[model samples]
Target: MKRNPRKVRWTKAFRKAAGKEMTIDSTIDFEKRRNVPVRYDRDLVQTTIKAMKRVGEIKARRERAFFKNRMAVSRETQRAHRRKIIEGVKAGVKLHEPMSVESPVSSKVQEKIKVTAKRHTALLPGEGRSMGMDID
Candidate 1:
């Protein structure tokens, strides 16, 4: 009995869309064809293979931060801050100094954003339910 050759499958998308024509993806070495797909995150595969082959050693200090680096508080501190703001306003004091906190987001800014968002959420007079952008 005789068997025929099976067709190769392509499971990879283009690296970057460059006009119309053939795609440039030579991730797999097809000198002798295997049953795997052509290209899928080639750089990731290369790095993984290199890592697998090495007896890995520790590197420099990791700059990455864990989630616990930022502390989360509620109610008390928030209410105190709000009271301070209100007192500042009532005492004829102008809140002009720019509060520069990390990630361009301070508590005051967040409160303002929440207020604006609430105002926007409320339906205007005779306004339809759908008045937002269509992502599609």
Candidate 2:
């Protein structure tokens, strides 16, 4: 079956078109194929290898930054959607007003309740003899 490269999800063309890949980066330009043939020198080969590694690192860093920025925007949109849902839920429910402590009914309720402090007794010097033995 014939498929359009730009529309195919797994194609490089699609990724570039969808802004999922870096299209205008200097590191990307370094990876382009050259038609001209060059004489192979040991120093040139070593320098080219180092340059390739550096370019790969730069590309990876830029890709990470791009992904982070994309995810940040996605997170903000998700937060806004959640806030809207919460607001809708709040609108559907009826909230009761808080009761005041100084109200007549509240004062009567408080008067009906009793609060007591508990006291603990400490052992005297003579009571210390039973500390080590268990009694039935």
Model 1, span 1-136: residue lDDT tens: 5332222222223212321222332322222366777577989899867754442221111111211222233456778899999998879975687865666656565552434334455544444546555445
What is the Cα-based lDDT of residue 118 in candidate 1?
A: 42
lDDT of each: 0.45, 0.86
Give the CA lDDT, 0 to 100, for residue 60 in model 2.
95
Model 2 C-alpha lDDT per residue in residues 39-77, reported as the tens digit of each score: 999999999999999889999999999989888999999
What are the TM-scores, per candidate, against the unseen true structure? 0.16, 0.66
Model 2 local distance difference test score = 0.86
The candidate maximizing lDDT is: 2
Query: Where is model 1 more than 4 Å wrong at Cα?
Result: 1-72, 93-136
